[model samples]
Target chain A: MLTKRIIPCLDIHERRVTKGVRFKNNIDLGDPVEMATRYYEEGCDELVFYDITASSERRPIDLEMVREVARAIRIPFAVGGGITSLDDMSAVLLAGAEKVSINTPAVLNPELIEEGARRFGAQCIVLGMDPVRSDNPACPSGYEITIRGFREYTGIDALEWARRAESMGAGEIVVNSVDADGTRAGFELNITRLIAENTGIPVVASGGAGNPRHLAEVFIKAGADAAIVAGMIHTGEYSIAQIKNELHQAGIPVRRHW
Target chain B: MTAIIDYGAGNLTSVKLALQTLGVDALITSDPDRIMAAERIIFPGVGAAGAAMESLRKLGLQEILHTVTSRGTPFLGICLGTQIIFQHSAEDGGVDCLGLLQGQVIRFAPADRRDKVPQMGWNAVSFVREHPVLKGIADGTEFYFVHSYYPVPDDDAAIIGQTGYAGVDFAAVTGRENIAATQFHPEKSGRAGLQLLENFLRWKP
Candidate 1:
């Protein structure tokens, strides 16, 4: 049986781990390498490090930080934010990360998804999408794709983009809800379910996880293959072991050993 | 010292790092002498079969790999390394592989959207028989996997373990004599993965 994954995401800013509520009211954390090592040791299935400010700053992800994290942790991790081209993708992968995610650059040049997949194999390419709820009929799923850290609306239907990206060779899709992110309410089940049920690839539900139940809801209700936690864990409100034990009791199969 | 063959593609750093964490000395190299002279050789990579094969040929590693296995140096293959060791691969529109083992690699044709193509995530491996490298790992212990194609060895005797996914029971671990290959990435599989690597380090076979 394939166990559902519990991944801890580290939103990086100036090489420090930071968490903001839906991209606002930023709270500085600690070093990424240290945080990543802690999560890995705690039995998190994977880790995601997003350079939150890199895309807006028009700079590539911090490769030195990536190298540090790679050397420190043995579990699989994905590095995203400000990955604009194939060279960037190669540098990140060669620097030791298992997967390289593209959000803004992917929307700017959809071919980047295809090219990255062609060059590095589909399993190495991850598509990180930030979608917010919208009533516009253009988005059949009522969720529109947002870019540049949720500052711009592309009017592209989230579900449709998922299907297109899959066709273009995206290995996995991280459906992070902009509306639900940092809310501590719960996952936006509507879009996560919509995309997970429709797409043939693995869907990682992100944003708005307040408790263990929220993670369970996304896994059972939304059909999410994995879920990302940042604020929930970073704030020390919960540990990865605590979360995984809760998931295990909830009957969700999660990796529990070191 | 263990040699992790570096033909330019695939996740080599993590493998080396994993070994180092196990307190084992491993080197990522393409030099034939170093790989052939090492106590063990790990042929690990991830990419298209055609391109991987091209890199191996360009670096003159094909013969070295064959020699390593034949000389009983205990060779282990991971993911792409496992796929290319087979006789042929359906990837890259029918690529001829290293042919170190008798098998054919085929892509997973999932019936619906529920079963993804790449089959990324952790899945359990059921032991079909005991092998040194996988010793002590319980049956149904899940390991991380990220690949679209899996190898079907010509003889069932080569299969040491099996995993079911996409409505198919495939050979997740295959071994015969000094060579063993896994469809999953042990280096990225956390504890169980490290255990497998540890077993490999101590494996006299």
Candidate 2:
């Protein structure tokens, strides 16, 4: 059976895990490697590490932090943010990341997605879509996709962009909701479902996970292959073990810990 | 020493780092001499079939890899590296491959009931046959995967492990003689993934 994934995301800046409300008011969490290893032990299916400061600083991925996390954990890790070129993707993959997540670079140069996918294989390439709902009545249900941590709007429809990404060879799409982020209300299931339904690639729903039931609802209702929980896990509100147990009881097939 | 073949494709760092974590001395190089001289070779790749094959030809590594594997030297192909072992790829409008294995790589059919391409994330696998590559690996172990195309072995007996996606059972791990390849990234698969790598290291054949 193809099981649903329960992923824990770590937003890293200067090698430390951090999170905030709406991508602002950043708060330091703890060492990324420690948190990653803990998540792995607690039965998280996989981990996503976004070098949130890399793109803003106009630099390469933090290989040091990547190496530390890779060395400590045994789970698959996806590294994102500031991955602009094939060289950047190669550097991070060599540094211990299983997959490279590209956002602004991929959109800026659509060929980069094709080239990267061709060079490394689509499976190694992941496209990150940070979407914010638009107020314009014409595009009510549609949202504006943001890049570089919500600094710039691509004016591209989220669902449309996700389909384009799949056509361009993105193996997976990380549908992150800017509106529901940090609110802990729940995941933006409508947005996630829209993307998942429109494409064939696995969809990982990010942002607004308040509890285990929230994760379950996202998988069961929205039909996401995985639900990414950051704030809830980082704040120690819910442990991954408990969440997996609850999800299992709720009929979601998650990887069980030995 | 283990030499990881680098053809300017995807990252070889994580594979190298994983080898280092296991206290194994490894090197990432495109040099044919070094690659051929290494005790074992890891054909690690993460890119498209056409470009990867092109880079291999550009670096003159195709023959070297053939020589090493032909001599019965241990060879492990990861992801695209595993796919290129076939005769050709349908990606990029058909590309010639190393022809190490007989078959053609094709894109996965979209979900019958409207599923997505590029099946990503952690998925489970069932071992097909007993082999050193999967030694100590139990059934129902979930390994991470990210790809749209999968290998169809010319010799069905070569397949050592299998995983299903969208109702299709694809080859997860295929072993023949000294050549062993995995569509999944064992380095990124966590504990079970690491254990699989360890088994590869200890494989005597």
Candidate 3:
């Protein structure tokens, strides 16, 4: 049976793994390779690396860091941030990254997603969405989406954007909630469920994971295909084996190693 | 030495790294001579079938692939490479494929609404038939897969493994003669995936 995945996301800036409060105020963690290897041994299903500085730097993904992490683990890894064109996707794929993620770029130019799916295959292209709750005069739920590390609001509805991404050939959608990120309260189940219900693509819920129960809650209540975690795993609050076991106990159908 | 065909498709780096991890000397090239001279050939692709075929034609690799595969050199196709072995793909209005096997590639349309189209992430596979390529592989082992289209073989005997999606068992692994292909990206599939690659390396055509 297909099971929900527990992914660990590593944010890379200047070749170092870092974690922050709501995608800002970065604090360096450690070497990416070491961190990635640790997660693999801990039984992580997959890994995601976001080059947080790529957009501002105006450069391609950091292939060196990508190579380091790729060399460290055998599990599937995805690289995102500042991916603007097919050439960028090709470069990341050539760097041993299994998948290339597109966020602001895909939102800005929807053709990037289409061309990416055309050139690199749909399965290899992931659309990353950062949604914030906006209570403005227009959007009551604060459903406006943001790009480039929550720096710019695209004024696009999150659910509508997810649907558009699927139509644009996005194979998977990573819904990162700005409100829930770094809060560690839990995943925004309502938002995740909305995206999952609206799109046929696999929805990976990112942000606001605190513990194993949180993982189970998201998988069961939110109807997410996968849950992305970073701080919980990085801080040693939970292990992958423990999370999978808990999910299994809760009837989540996770794959066991033994 | 293994020649990894490089016609501007994605995921060649990981495949090459996997081969190297197994201590096999692997070279990424589009040259027909280099590919023909190798002990084994690996065709790794991650992109549209039509565009990939176009690139292969542009680089004159279609003939090279045909020539090498005919000579009984071990060939392994991964992901999109696997899809291209069929007669045609429904991805881009029926694009012609390499036709190494008798099959047509079609998008996975799950009857269940819960089942996604791409079927991204890891899923378990059950072996339906025994073959050297899957020698040490066990039934009910999970492998990572990310694709929208799956191969529907004309000859059912070509299928070695199958996975259920929305209650329909789909081909996970397909083979004929010296050629074998997997819908999953073995290079990214962890220990089981590595073991499968090892089996391919040791497989006798």
Candidate 4:
């Protein structure tokens, strides 16, 4: 059986690990390499490092930081944010990161996804989207895709975009709910389920993870293959061991070796 | 010295880094001479079968691989490298592979809606028989896997480990004599993965 993944996302701002509520007013948490190593040692299935400010600031991802993190951890990790071209993807993969995620640039060009999948296998390409709930009649799923850190709306339906990205060769889709991001209320089950069921690719439920029970709910109810945790584990209140132990007790299959 | 083959397929840095963590500084190379001269060879790749086969031919590695395996130099394949070792692959409109092993690679046709293509993430491996590379690793230990096509060897003796996914029980580990291959990326599988590589380093067969 394939175990459900528990990934700890490290949102990097100026090479430091930062956390915020709904991507606003983030506080520095320390070195990304240190945090990534800690999470890997604690038995997190995988790791994701997003350069949160790279797209808005219009700069490439910090490759030095990527290289340092790649050296610090033995598990697979994905690097995203400000990955605009194939060269950017190549650099990140060569730096030892397994996958490169494209969000804003992918939405704008769309062909970048195909080219990346063609050059480097689709397994190394991940599509990260920030979707917010909307009541617009145009979006059949009632969720619209947002870009540039959720400050702008594309009016494209989240489910439609996910299907298109999968056809265009995205290996996995990370549905990071903008409305539920960092809220700790719970995962936006409706939207996550909508995308997970509609697409054939692996769906990683991101944003709004509060506890192990919340993760179990997303995995069992929403059909999520993986879930991302930031605030729940980064605050020092809950460790990865506790989270996985709780998931184990709840009967959700997760890797138990630390 | 171990040579990690780089045939312009996909990421080979992580494989080298994994070996580095085990205190073995493996070299990543595309040169046939270096690969032929190495004490061990790790053929690691992530790509389509057609493109990988083309690159392998372009770099003239097919014959080198054949000669190395025949010499019993202890060779290992990972991911795409595993699929390409078979006789043929169904990917990219039916690609004829290296035929190093008597098997054909086929894609998963899952009747279950939840079973996605390119089955990614960790899955447990059930050993059918013992091999030196998997000596210390316990049976039913999980390893990281990310692929759409899997190899089906013609001879069951070649299969050392098996895994079930997408309504198919496929070969997760297969080999004969000195040649062993894994459909999973042991380099990216953390502790258990590193253990497989460490065992490969010390493997005599």
Best by lDDT: 4
**lDDT tens per residue, model 4, B51-130:** 99999999998999999989999889999999999999999999999988999999999999899888999888999998
Give per-residue CA lDDT, model 2, range A38-61, as digits (tens). Answer: 888888888999988889899888
Model 1, B1-205: lDDT tens digits are 8899999776688898889889987888999899878998898988888999999999998898888899899889999999999999999899999999998999998786677778888888999999999887888888999888999999999999999888899999998898999999999998899999999888887
* Residue-wise C-alpha lDDT for candidate 3, range B123-177, written one tens digit per residue: 8888988877777767888888878889999999989899887667889999889
- Per-model DockQ against the true two-chain complex: 0.66, 0.47, 0.56, 0.75
Give the lDDT of residue A235 in candidate 4. Answer: 90
DockQ of 2: 0.47
Q: Candidate 1, residues A81-123: lDDT per residue as tens digits?
A: 9899999999999888999999988998999999999888888
Clashes by residue pair, model 1:
none
Q: Could you tell me the TM-score of chain A in candidate 1?
A: 0.98
Which portion of correct inter-chain contacts appears in model 1?
Answer: 0.68
Candidate 4 wrong stretches, greater than 4 Å: none
Q: Best to worst by lDDT, what's the order?
A: 4, 1, 3, 2
Candidate ranking under TM-score, highest first, comes to 4, 1, 3, 2
Q: Which pairs, if any, clash in model 3?
A: A121-B47, A133-A142, A134-A142
* i-RMSD per candidate, Å: 1.6, 2.5, 1.6, 1.1
Best by TM-score: 4
User: Model 3 segments beyond 4 Å from truth?
Assistant: A24-26, A54-61, A84-87, A107-111, A140-142, A151-154
